[model samples]
Target: MATTILETCRVPAPPGAAANLSLPLTFFDIQWLHFHPIRHLLFYDYPCSKPYFLETVAPKLKESLSLTLRHYLPLAGNLIFPLNSEKKPEIQYVAGDSAVSLTIAESASDFDHLTGNHARDADQFYEFVPEIDPVTDESEYQRVPVVALKVTLFTGRGICVGFANLHCLGDASSVVGFIKAWASISKLGGDEEEFLTKHAESLPILDRSVINDPLGIDTIFWKVIRDVPLKSSSFPLPTNRVRATYILRQADIEKLKDLVLAKKPGLLQVSSFVVTASYVWTCFVKSEEQVDDDDVLQVFIFAADIRARIDPPVPASYFGNCLAYGLAKIEHKQLVGGEGFVIAAEAIADQIKNRLNNKDQVLKGAENWLSETKEMTAIRAFGVSGSPKFDLCSADFGWGRARKLETVSIDGEKHSMSLCKSRDSEGGLEVGISLPKARMDAFAAIFEEGLRF
Candidate 1:
């Protein structure tokens, strides 16, 4: 698990990009104002030596990233917060002052063991993933970095590209769009014209006005933030954490859906995602051998892409965070008992149906979000991160598809799981979970036995 740092440099957007840009945060974006940053690592198998990678691939990556930043200037910017505490924070980009920090490193770790399905030490990944510096106090303003990146060469084995971005800057949909665009540019060797022709529709829509917060949720959220202490945007991953991946084929998803329908035939929102998330949620609850109180409440938290759900409908290409929180709660007894999967599935599905479909319900509890988030910290809550729709594997970057993509941010105390499209099978899904050794073993056993039916 040794890593040697080769270089640390900043990559700026091309001169053609608009400079002195300031984008205000919408209500959806404000929800994550002080939340932990999101980190992702995409592994590609490239049996090449460090010298070759440095001489060829690294330059292309940096150049392509610079070109990609022209369209996503916010990535190279900083979030400026006024120390006055009255004005809302905004992402501001100044041509000469802003650039994304990129770290070049070489890791001697085992590429296969790190990316395999079997459990591996989560801390081993800390070496390759770049860190986002904490907010720094500036006179009259506090500046926070929006994004940072790293490229690690596993000499003669594979290369791992890592990204860390502020959650307030974008959601999964927004970030994934940037990754795909960067890959397309890198694939074409930073050919702006050719990349434009092929990826014209992929460019992000930077207009923040489309996100209408009719309920004044923005003001309410800021007030809430003003009341509570802001959370640190740092990855304090605990030791002894192990991560494992589980694949659920299309058949397994259908089986789970059928199982749920057998008991509740009229359920309206039993999509592939719902069943998959629920099954994992149930397994996680059962694996927690310490929570024996059947009456204890367990909350399930997740985010839903709201591009098409909002009134007047936002464009799918709209950049930045356009998400609504989906929450469901049930007693531990119901979630872990017989028919636990079905129970969990129904609860989550109902929440999604009502939260996303009804505009009024979309921001129903907006005022309570901060307080509830605090309460969730005390209760046993299960959350989900990433989504299968993002399709991280499709980010080819001209080196074939990614060997594996992981949401390394979920390895903390959040008790969250990551979802992605399976690499081996179409229509299948991959689940990445991190937990202590004992809980991981229990979860793995329950996950397998439940699939036998």
Candidate 2:
């Protein structure tokens, strides 16, 4: 399958948008300063005329994107580290000219295979993601685009809207909100005024100061990550690594939950997420061969949104990152041994509770934890990205809802998995995981066997 680039252009905010706006980064935003761009793809099947898409649909998408930017002005700007400034870098939305790069392309790939619910090669989705290159000046100050978009028409089958956003700009919730807003506008024929009036309830709060960090977390975060070098290659996964999507049906999820409750009858925190995460973590550990050191620690690192947990709660629609990472650690033997699921679930649930209960302390100690953990070269780490809570399947443009939504960028990273609610919206879950080919096969076996009560 080959993808051909047709055209590339910039889509700026609509007229009368606030000009020369500078939004300071909070500790949550700066914590992910060196992280990779978040890539997401939404595939839609429109078996209609190519002329219809080019002449009608394409123009609406571009126009709607412009209007969407009017509300999300920061996305049209860049993140720059200003020279001689004591404060950390910030997002600057320059008035008239700043815009997001939009690439128009065409692909002849198998649309069904790419969007199918089953597993396929992780690398295949890379072609649909656009490259977001951050430019650096002679003074060594770096300026990076906050977002880039690509629209590809899969000849005679469907179209895909590819998104790439710098993690610092926002979290998954913010990005999905942006996408839904764009789609809503596109469906309404790019009516900016109608979009504003109709979806008035969903407008994002761009102010970042509400997240009062009394502990000076922003400074601590910058100091800790400033020296860590950026990844040399954007595409760092080994060739042998592969990605697959696994489903946890509603019945299976409930069964897992029941199993956890059976072991600990008083366990009130075992939800689908906790149980599913525990199952995956245990399978991952069991798939790997036993290590010489039984005491080696296996860590499960996941993030939680502090939007409503903080003292002065941040708005749900607040734009920018508002997440705190939660870590759960267990010795290798204990993690793979019998009763692993129960132990993992208990630890994860407890950690989550602790994080919420001591939100301030957690935020304050985040940098310190990173500093100490970075030195542990031998510890094994696993993390879960993307959440089922972010109902991505409901993102509907005019034509229809997305056939599939994928987190393609994380596939290249080791021991990282993506989770989202099932497309059917039946209280099930869809998990995208990547591993060495052999380990993936072994993990599949363990995943299936463990669920068979």
lDDT of each: 0.88, 0.81
Candidate 1 lDDT over 1-453, as tens digits, reads: 489999999999988788679999887888788777898999999899888989999999999999999999999999887665788878999999999999999999889999999999888888878888777877777787899999999999999999999899999899999999999899988889998998788789999889877788888887767544444465675557898999999999999999999999999899999999999999999898777577999999988898888777899989999877778899988888897889889989998888877776876776677777878878989898999888977898898999998889888656999999999878899999999999999999999999995
lDDT at 314, model 1: 92
Residue 414 CA error for candidate 1 (Å)?
A: 2.5
Return the top candidate by lDDT.
Answer: 1
Those runs of model 2 whose alpha carbons end farther than 4 Å from true positions after fitting are 83-85, 138-140, 227-233, 237-239, 357-364, 367-369, 372-378
Residues 1-453, model 2: lDDT tens digits: 599888899988888888778888887888677777888888887886667877887888889998898888999998876544455788988977689899988898999888875556777787888778646553645677888899999878999989988888899889889989989899888877898898888899997777887788788777766665343226554446677778899999988888888899886668788888888999999999668888988898888888888777888999998887777899988988898888999988888777744756556566575564454324688888899787776777786878787887776555778898887648889888877778888988898887775
Structural RMSD, model 2:
2.1
Error of 2 at 233 (Å): 7.1
